[model samples]
Target: MRPSSALVLAFAASTLAQDQIPLVDKVKGWFAQATAAVTSAVPAAASSPVASGRAKVAETIQHPLTLENWKETLTVDPSASTPTTQEWLVYITGGNATCFGFCGNATKAWNASLPFLAAKPNAPKFAVIDCDAEPLLCNSWSVGPPSLYYFQIPKPLADQSAPAATVRYQPLNRTSTTVDTFKKLVLDNDFEKVEPYEGYFHPFNGELQQYGLALPLAYVMWGFSKMPSWLPMILISFMSRTFM
Candidate 1:
C-alpha cells in the first residue's frame, strides 16, 4: 500500500537517527579500548628492573669533594708546612672520588719525587689541591683535571700597598708528565723569562740588544779598517780636489 507523505518522512528521520547512534557508539567504544591499553602499560613499565638498575648505578657514582672540604695537606694541614717566599709547583688533581686511572697515575708520579724536589736549596714550593674540591681556584689557575702548574705569588714590595700579582709559569715546550721531566723543566728554564716579575729581569737581553745594535757598525768599520791607512787620506784629497 502507498504510505502517507508525512508518515514516510517521519520513518526516514527515525532510520537516520538510528544509523547515526550506532556510529557514535562505535567511536566511543574504540576510544575506551585505546585508553585502557595505555593505562595497563604504564604500571608494567614502571615495575621494570632495568629502570631500577639504572637508578642503583646513578646512586653508586661518587661525586667529587666540595670546596669546603679542601685542606692544605694530603691528609692533614701539617704543622711544618710553612709558607715560602719562592715560586710554587701546584699539582691540580681530580677524579679520585671516581677512581679515575689517569688521576691515580699522575698523583702517584708526583708523590714519588716531591720529597726530593722539596729538599733542594732553591727549589720551588709544592702544593697539591684537588681540582674538583676547589673548582674556583682550579679555574683561576686555568688548568683542567689531572694537570700540573707552576704558580708564583710574589710578595708586595715594602713600598707598595696593593696585592701581589699571581705569576703562572709557562712551559716553553715541555709536555712530559713525568717527575724527572718536570724537574728538568724546573731546572732548565728560568722563571724570570715569564712576565709579571718584580725586581727580576733578563740581564743578558740588554747586552744582547746592545751587541745587536753595534754589530753592523762594527762590521763596516772592520772592512774599512782592513784597508790601508793611506786610502782614507787619498780619498779625502780626491774629494777635496773634485769639489774645489
Candidate 2:
C-alpha cells in the first residue's frame, strides 16, 4: 500500500526538522486579527436575539474560529476533523499607500474569483474580507479604493480558533489581480511560518441548509431559545465527543 499521508508527512517533517521552521509564527499573524474580530463583532453578538450573547457569541464565534496563535495552543480534536486549511491576504491602495483597513473593491474582486475556483476540487474554500475600514481603520464598512484580501475558508470549523491564511504577497499591479496569480504567489514561501495543521468536518453547508437550517425548516427551531442551555451543551458535547 502507498505510504500513509501521515507517514509521508512524518518523513518530510523529519527531513525538514533541522530547518528551524517557524510554522505557527508565520500563521500567528491572526492573533491581533482574532482579538479584533472578537472585539468588533461583540457588538453584533450583544444585540443578538439571545440574552447571554456573551456565551452564544463566544460559542458560535468559537465554532467558526481562526488560527492566530495556533502553535502556542492547539486544543481542538484534529483527528476527527477534515483538513481545510485557510488564509487571508490583504492588499491596500489609496491614502498614501497606508492601509486604513478592509476594502469593498477587494471583496468584489474576490466575489469575481469564486467561479474560477470551481476547478480546485480539493483546495480549501475561499472568501474575501474587505479590510478598507474594519480592523485597520473605521469600525464600520465603507466604500473605498480597491484592495485585495484572500482567505481559505477551510472546511468551516477547520480549527478551533479558525485563523485563515493571508497568502504571502508583494505588490502586483495596481488596477487588477487574478485569484490564480494570488494563489501562485503565496503557496510556496519557504520563510512563511505554517505549522498549525489541524482538521475538522464542516457541519453547516448547503445540504444542511436544505434539510435543517434551511428557511422554513430552521423556523421550526424558532422557539429553540426556550430549550435549556444544559441540553444544548449536552448535545453539542455529545456530538463533538462522538466524532472527535
Candidate 3:
C-alpha cells in the first residue's frame, strides 16, 4: 500500500527541521563564540606593555586637579618615608562647552608634552584643571583658561599656613615650540622669564568678587525686566530726538 500524501509531507517537514538549526540555538552558538573571543582577548590586552604604560601615565603623570583635590596637589603626603620636593605644573584648560578658539593649539602642546614630561627625571607633578568643571577654583586663581601655572609647594606638606610660589608660563606659538619651551621651563626651573601669578588662591575671595560684580548687573537686569516692553522703544525715540 502507498503512503498517503499527508504522511509524505509530514516526513519531509521532519527531515527539514532536523537538517536546520533552530533560531534559538544559532543565537546561543553566536553568543558563545563572542564570549570566547572576548575572554581570549582580555589576557592579551592585559599583558600589553603599551596598555600598562598608558595606564601608569594616566594615574601618576596626569593628575587631575579639582576643587576637592586642589589642596592635595599643593600638599605632600605625610605617609611618605621621605619628603618629596616635586613641584606642581598645572595646566588649566576650558571645558568642551566653554572652550574658546585659542585652546586648540595650547591643548595639543600640553598633551604632547605629557610623554616627554613623564620621562624626565625629577619632573614636576603634572596636573590639569578644567575651568568648566571648577569655575570657582579657576576664578580664584584669577587666570584665564589655556594657561599654565607652576607652583612651588612648601615642604612639610602639613604646613598649610605657608604660602606657595606661583608663576605663569608666557604664551608661545606652535605646538612644537610650546613643548620645547615647557620642557625648558621645567628643566631649568627659571621663573625670571615667566610672570608671577599674583592672584589670590582663596575661594571665598573669588566668590565675593564675582558677586560684587554680578549684583550690579543683576539689579539693572531686574529693573529692565520690570519695565514695560514698549518703554525701550519710547526711550530710543526720545534719545534720537534729543540727539537730533
Instruction: At residue 176, give the lDDT of candidate 3.
Output: 38
Q: How many backbone clashes does candidate 2 have?
A: 27
Between prediction 1 and prediction 2, which has the larger TM-score?
Answer: 1
lDDT of 3 by residue, 1-244 (tens): 3344444443444444333535564465556556766777565444467545654665566778875687666655456433444467788776332232345566666776678876768667778877767655665454456777776654544544444444555544423346666677766655457766454332223343446643343334334434554555565556557655
- Give one digit per residue, the lDDT tens place, for model 2 in 111-162: 3444444334443333222222222221111112354323344433634545
TM-score of each candidate structure, all chains considered together: 0.38, 0.27, 0.51
The lDDT of each candidate is 0.45, 0.35, 0.57
Candidate 3 matches the true fold with a TM-score of 0.51
- Model 3 ranges off by over 4 Å: 1-60, 79-84, 157-177, 190-192, 199-244
TM-score for candidate 1, please give it: 0.38
How well does model 2 score by local distance difference test? Answer: 0.35
The weakest ten consecutive residues by lDDT in model 1 span 197-206
Candidates 2 and 3 compared: the better one by TM-score is 3
Question: Per-residue error at 169 for model 2, in Å?
Answer: 3.9
Comparing candidate 1 with candidate 3, which one achieves the higher lDDT?
3
